[model samples]
Target: MFTIPSPTIVNTSSRPLSETTIVRRKTRPVRVGHVTIGGGHPVVVQSMINEDTLDVEGSVAAIIRLHKIGCEIVRVTVPSLAHAKALSEIKQKLVETYLAVPLAADVHHNGMKIALEVAKYVEKVRINPGLYVFEKPKPNRTEYTHAEFDDIGEKIRETLEPLVVSLRDQGKAMRIGVNHGSLAERMLFTYGDTPEGMVESALEFIRICESLDFRNLVISLKASRVPVMLTAYRLMVQRMNELGMDYPLHLGVTEAGDGEYGRIKSTAGIGTLLADGIGDTIRVSLTEAPEKEIPVCYSILQALGLRKTMVEYVACPSCGRTLFNLEEVLHKVREATKHLTGLDIAVMGCIVNGPGEMADADYGYVGKQPGYISLYRGKEEIKKVPESQGVEELINLIKADDRWVDP
Candidate 1:
């Protein structure tokens, strides 16, 4: 039987009250192919391809494209038995052409057979609990009796047991993904269209999986509205704490539209939970190309100091006291040093804020005088150079310290 570990407690009375790091919630590690989620792993980034799984070559190409660009896991929708069968080809072609990218199959709307089929090919299987044993709504029915609820619950267990057993035996993972919009009819009637319903919906599925001794599970409670998404995940965590369940959570905001607002909405929901140390894996569902979502995922993780994938640039918003064209110089500095991962570079417009503001940066390019720029290694001003040669001087400084790599 699986047991949840006790949550870690730290004493900070002797130290500062504030912490600069995010303390992630304790969760058991659930491996999905070569990658592991939770158990103090770096938060994993994932995105789904929109291609039809029936087109095996197209799907293989799409998965490779996403995996090459740092999407740790790629999900493909398996709507029908045929699509589920096509994953066999997709997995084989990936191994033959590129590499064995960790793949997940999104199975929904009475997807027992589909899930079982695709589970043979993919590392993980994601199911919408509300749709897994889909209960179509009765427009006239207002409420469900306790017996009726338990009766349908039994049916869900019967249908889910095979998949759980299959995954448990195969050493694969399952995601109990609950969407606020798609709560089962019984859940909607029992708890209404709220976060409570979403949590309960996931809990029902979770209990069934646990009953079968299948514990390699990840959970997600996602909603398009930030408040609903946030509240549902929080409630789920509370319940899990009480129940001694330590399943890792997969965080996302489903159908977060496209473009700027989509990114903001995704960040608002995913970022908030991550700040509170809530998620183990994340997906930013944008209506744009799947490739566009990877950068946003890394940016969120980078901004939170959870992961460092690119140079961290610290630039001040220019003011009248500025000594150079701040925006232009910042751009030039970025272009020259963007490839330097794991380094913090600061661009400050004036000496007033330059040294102090960029004290923690690995390197700094600051406005020293009208026609010159100050170069810094940490807080010390190394030299002043002509504005035209500032970027070159920064590169020279980095090379001097043996940190420059050819890009």
Candidate 2:
């Protein structure tokens, strides 16, 4: 057997662990729902349920499931007056049920009534800036001039301003959610399609909001393309520093695909920003159901050392000396431990190589015979367990010992 360094990281024992090597971007704290953003909190995970706005029970159940899967915040689309009403019921249910996380209401209107109605219930009101009801605009005026375009934007801001004030006054949080696809056409026409243009447009509105004396805000500059999304956020972060504004950032790669491509796009865009300490909260916006996002979000945070709870698994790819069906066995072990948060388990093959791979593991299965397996933890053989009971035995061992618990 061959020897190699283990990929599984050691637990925090305060035993001379390596210091965080990267420099983090410092930003002020913002409260979104019950979770705190910025000011050194663990990076939060969020998911949006694309369900009926008035379906209060459906939305509440969806959010409860999201919470169980470690989603810190849940954003629901409030497309109309009815959906806004649902938010009121949803928020009341959340309070009565004793689920403490905050709700976010997403509104794409150019008006404030919806924002105001949901503001009382939601922790954050996500406003996708637009001229009030621009999607369903009035008939074209007799010879629309350039001022018409500019007027539409200003008018939209005007509609949003009072609502923004109401939200601030009523203690509702807000996120300036900008989409690369729907960048105000006039701004796109003026600056052309570029990262600087997108960020400039976002900051332009941000400044407009700031001029109103509102500071409790977060910002999102999302692009479907990973590089464009990365570029936009980096530029926005740089400008936020230049202006000394301290709003927590919300990060995502918008419309990131399903399964592998979506995962790759999100990882590339979100991962790049996170590695530089630029993002405060993250979302894996896949084309699939919201539940698919939870594990991916946690994995990204784990890779960046931004999250604490996890089961770090280390196993060797089958390479001949790997006795037994290590592949299938490792899969079983990993599958079993998905629900076991905050424990580190290692399933490896070969007595000679497996111990080194599991040197940092809390409980390990090194190699197996036809019926039994060799077990070790911290360089000592503990006991042998049947192959059938291996995964459960490992789990029971972890829960019994406090070694894997966060220090």
Candidate 3:
């Protein structure tokens, strides 16, 4: 890949069959277990295990759950030697069993031990500058002078940098998952509480690691706030460009809450960056089981038009024109087809809007009589399916056509 891209001249056919102006950032590949992360991997979706590490079976069980939901990479917290010891067994179970998803070990504070124990078995290790600190503000902390915060920040990097050098020496795939909330206070003080400040803090670590000749690197900058997360990444990308760095970017919104709100917030942050072609991998952090992360991550990727597979569900918001109990039918269809595994299906209220709405679906349904729907496979009606059986019939038709997914 070239450091600077050649200028684009669009061939004139009147419409775009290819993205003419999109310049993909040059990146080297970084593999995590069976899956690839950076350097043009297909924007993989990942999640982490939230189970107790001591229970190896339970931890593997959590990984299995994430795998079933289409998670490509799953991370586990290895805070102690016990958790570190379990990684080899956990990896053995994953490769031998069905969930061959790659494993990442989250190592904080105790960097040298984490490196010593997990460097061999795990595919990736997460290093955070903030993890070295106790994360406390002492009494009258709000009134602390600038120097105290600066010292706190400096002390953290001093605790963490040796591990970056050690991991580099050990030749391990390392991901620097930077925390926006715990950014070095000195950087924050110098650059203010802005996205530039966040990027400056992260780039510091990247520079340190790069100085050690560690080329196998992935970077993430996560914030609980959506705008902060977005702008920080934009600024980081800009900075990386200026420095000629092409590390794979990990897209995420940390601590996003649960269910609809969480999904939306994650979409708003991670989704925006992805849509702009800036993300290479994604993790949607919710304070829930890792299983929930997989589906949401897949959905976001699907929405971005990056991954194609079994089914795509498109439903209309109920309106005056809607008939045949649209909302009820939509819920049933969505629930039934959730496991389609790259399946594309759309459910709509009436042909008054459904056909135009679902022009892209592999199989779709629009309102007919009170108990029927207009069944469609790419503009041609195969039959009028009974509304009660619409969900099952559509899924079966997809299965028959694709011959790829397990029904």
> In terms of lDDT, which candidate is strongest?
1
Q: Across residues 1-407, which tens digit of lDDT does each residue of candidate 1 receive?
A: 12223333333112234977888899999999999999999999999999999999899989989998899999999999999999999999999989999999999999999999999999999999889997877878867888999999999999999999999999999999999888888887777787878888888889988888999999999999998888888888888887999899999999999999999999999998898888999999999999999999999999999999999999999999899998998899889988888999999999999999999999999997899999999988899999999999999999999999999
lDDT by residue (tens digit), candidate 2, 1-407 = 12222222222112233556444567778877568887778788999887786887888888888988899989899878888988878878877885856788888855478887878788888887533345443354233357776676677677778877887787667888888887655555555566666677677668777888877788898899987887778778777767878788899999998999999899999988887778888899999999999889999888776785677777877777776688898888877676566556778777877777788777788775557787777677887888777777776676567543322
Quote each prediction's TM-score. Answer: 0.96, 0.83, 0.80
- Candidate 3, 1-407: lDDT as tens digits: 01222222222122234763333455678877667776767888888888877788998888888877678878889888878888888888877876566777888873656655877677788877555455553444334466776676566556656666665665567888878887654544456566666677677767767766777788898999998898778777877776888888889999999988998999999887776667789999988777778778877877767776446778888787777787788778877776566656777887787778788777788886678877888777777878878877777776667743554
Predicted candidate 3: what Cα RMSD to the true structure?
6.8
Q: Rank the candidates by lDDT, best first.
A: 1, 2, 3
lDDT value, candidate 1, whole model? 0.91
Better of 1 and 2 by lDDT: 1
Question: How many collisions between residues are there in candidate 2?
Answer: 2
In model 3, residue pairs whose N, Cα or C atoms come closer than 3 Å (at least 3 residues apart or on different chains), thus clashing, are 309-342, 310-342, 310-343, 310-344, 311-342, 311-343, 311-344, 312-343, 312-344, 312-345
Q: Which 10 consecutive residues of model 3 have the lowest summed lDDT?
A: 1-10
Off by over 4 Å in 2: 1-23, 98-100, 130-157, 351-353, 368-373, 379-407
lDDT, candidate 2, equals 0.76
Cα-based lDDT at residue 346, candidate 2: 78
The stretch of ten residues in a row with the least summed lDDT in candidate 2 is 6-15
Model 3 stretches with alpha carbons more than 4 Å out: 1-26, 92-101, 132-171, 335-338, 368-372, 383-406
Name the candidate, 2 or 3, with the larger lDDT value.
2
